[model samples]
Target chain A: MSDTAQAARAVIGDSEFDRDTAVTLREPGVYGIDLSAGWTIINAVNGGYLLSVLGRALADALPHSDPFTISAHYLTASQPGPAVVRTDVVRTGRTLSTGQASLFQYDDEGREVERIRVLASYGDLDSLPDDVRTSVKPPSFPPMEQCFGPEDGPAPVSGSSAIAERLMLKLDPATLGWALGSPSGKGEMRAWFGLADGRDADPLSLLLAVDALPPTAFEIGLSGWVPTVELTVHVRSRPAPGPLRVSITTRNLAGGFLEEDAEVWDSADRLVAQSRQLARVRVG
Target chain B: MSDTAQAARAVIGDSEFDRDTAVTLREPGVYGIDLSAGWTIINAVNGGYLLSVLGRALADALPHSDPFTISAHYLTASQPGPAVVRTDVVRTGRTLSTGQASLFQYDDEGREVERIRVLASYGDLDSLPDDVRTSVKPPSFPPMEQCFGPEDGPAPVSGSSAIAERLMLKLDPATLGWALGSPSGKGEMRAWFGLADGRDADPLSLLLAVDALPPTAFEIGLSGWVPTVELTVHVRSRPAPGPLRVSITTRNLAGGFLEEDAEVWDSADRLVAQSRQLARVRVG
Candidate 1:
């Protein structure tokens, strides 16, 4: 790997999200990430991690600088290595800019295949005018001290994926019915999350934070990794700067697939990020 | 105009959606839409109409004919003209296939510029596994007879955009607080909808139907066409062949932006589609 690619891979393996998202802007609309092997879920990487990589590029590429909303359509699985981020600005307004980006890598034959394509709007959070707020509220769960992650609860069989080890998780214990060999029967998980590397919650980290919770479908008795096919992330507001409180809920698990909706609130109780994805359902 | 362009333009102007979405699949991974002028929301075309066009490309691009989920990011505002739809298949499984599509139009300079980029998953709704369904029910509204659309709605002082005239909509009278010179102050609208041309609700029409309702922010007094920044449409199941029952609600109107969640039920009373969008909030 080139020194640049090696450096990006280091960031991906690093636990500090700030470090992970420290994407090097090689030039206009070109950002590169040095992806490490540890970020892999099985062999291919976790889609959310790649989203953060692109999110970092997007936040820097535009004047708004905040990923107010982003959605990624996974085209192919991105392998662990040097990957390139390419972006195009469609329309830039005083408030928001419309753009699209692709995360890609070249095969040994020198052909580029994009792994993900994102259409996003970057905006300044401060510019949003206040309106009559709605009554939608995040679910209240016990604070961080009362939560336990997959490792702290029912340990996965001996060899867990390295990606599992890298995630610093704290899932609410009350929702861990799956740990007792009995599933909650409801695909939902609420927890407090941040990077194991201790990076504070920022726009890019918030993107990763929403997807960090183990698939809510796991508690409902499904097995295997439910890879996200398409994900839509709505950055409601900037986080209050802390480990985000997250709720991942799957309303219906049907048709060999399911939809997972995530709500992420900052410590101050402000809803910071919301995301929904359609994923293939593997019934184990 | 060439015969092909004229034929395509006719489809867009036609009120019938099934025929409008009959995108010409020239070959695998390629579809085309003859653009027409009436779909414009003011000078720029409505974003939702573009999505349905892409949805048509996707459903036909894959083996699974039903559009289970689609999310679109508008790159550039497409004018009324000829556009090519190109799709790239990422993964095609027996049940669900993951893919991405781009709609491109040539500029006066003859450069191909993308107008929309979409990531979607195609699935057979019938194959969804049964689960403990949620009890969250739809709101009880007066049957379609009590609702009235914009024409029957508070008459626009003068020339309204032709796009408004093309939609056959009727809002449940209770939610039209803005019409009385008194805003409901709450961002919500429950309405019954169908295309003025009388198109049946399929996956693509269902996509347009959710966006068909006036932005919920309108009821709360926000004015000017609030353009959709990003839209994610999840087709929970195929819609029954009829006009859809739509309930549009904005959970929180903050930072000059808000999230609109739409639940569309078919005549059979089954929830056929659900969508969420992030749109600009313009205070009147």
Candidate 2:
């Protein structure tokens, strides 16, 4: 349609995820982002998808490539439209590099609105020590064939979540009560996350995998609109190039807010990433 | 003592916890910090105590007083000395205020070094809905009297931890093996934390409480030095005055790194705060 769109597609590749989160450098520190309409969670874009878009820009601008820790505060709900990402390199150390990225969009009134602010550290994940010791066992679920695969069709939980279209998510049937009108009364969700186009997951895409599940509170019968306020992701290691096993658990909910903790294990049964997020909840 | 120290003490009050975390306004965006020698974990200042010092400045600079969510990345080890804190108010919204604060100390070469960088969201915790629904149970511990009280004497696990002197911590005997010759092979620690001076626990001090316990890895026989790389704290509610029950658990350790998750429950048995931290480990 436009030269910028064609150019971004050329650089970002053919995958829907890659094409949607693709960023084009506008200047030394500015990046032009075209948010895709195919990644909405309801009326707004998914916070995790928004984070990946910002992460891509940070990976390019910073000296280090992989993000060890990234923290983002969502200021407002973002829509599918044109936005700009501005990154500032905070510190470049021997092992880790810290940076900040902010996404801004224009309001209908033609005013610049800041959508999200992120602080992150980037380093090569492969450079980390190749050893693992875990006190917690990997989550137990039925084999990939036993769970409800994405091919079974879409679950219309969110009115218009185009995100359900791009990413293929397989949920454990035991925890799928929230979508069947009879919530299981448990504040937990376990699923397998991957791309429909068969694109392998990398450290950048794992950012999305962490927040890709339905709200954990939904299973507990508090099916109100949950908006993420802040999210922090710790990328421990690179994924093993297959669908990721993801589990999100909510332990506490108070003061109209709740905390969701997520752990993702790769196909090789290794813990790849962990995340903790806080969101505002409306109790019905 | 310098005038700045005296003035800071005068403004911060008589509590040892308050005096150490005191902040004095030096300019519009900068506050002076006098790191006390009493909060060292081993050779460096405690990461949680350092976060509180920064939080105090953020509380004074931002429009909101209580920190809803705060995330900090440790760049370098900090020593007992004078450091300056620079805060930037990113956005002031109707419900939440977002800001960033960086703590800087002068290195031996006279160059300014950023010891820690933080991004936080502040809000009125009192304004939140007074409702609680928890899927997870609060950690149970023996009565405070049964645990190893601070009045009994100091545990010489850390050669020089003045923090143990300022904060009266009572460790659950079951988890105190690391302090003795034998370290249990479990990666968890539980303790009751309070101020020796009888100062009550507040939202700001809760930041310190989350990290007051010894590293959880120690309990697992990994007695090596563990330094925090990134920490995120979500203040769920205001604490009821009294000692706080704290527990730290490490579930995963990989690539010379580990994740420590902590939960703090108030005297009223309400979940007050929760934190997740990632740290670097040197295996011996």
Best by TM-score: 2
> In candidate 2, what are the lDDT values of residues A33-58, reduced to their tens digit?
88988878767798999999999999
True contacts kept of each: 0.62, 0.80
- Model 2 residue B48 lDDT? 87
- Cα deviation at B24, candidate 1, in Å, is 4.9
> What C-alpha lDDT values do all the predictions have?
0.74, 0.85
**For candidate 1, lDDT tens digit of each residue in A47-166?**
778898888788778777888888887767788888889988767877777677888888889798778878788888766665437557778788777777655644552125666565
Question: Ten consecutive residues with minimal summed lDDT in candidate 1 chain A?
Answer: A1-10
Q: After superposition on all CA atoms, how large is the RMSD of candidate 2?
A: 4.2
RMSD (Cα, Å) for all candidates, in order, is 5.8, 4.2
Label model 2 with its docking quality class.
medium
Interface RMSD for all numbered candidates = 2.9, 1.0
Q: After superposition, how far is residue B205 of candidate 1 from its true place, in Å?
A: 0.6
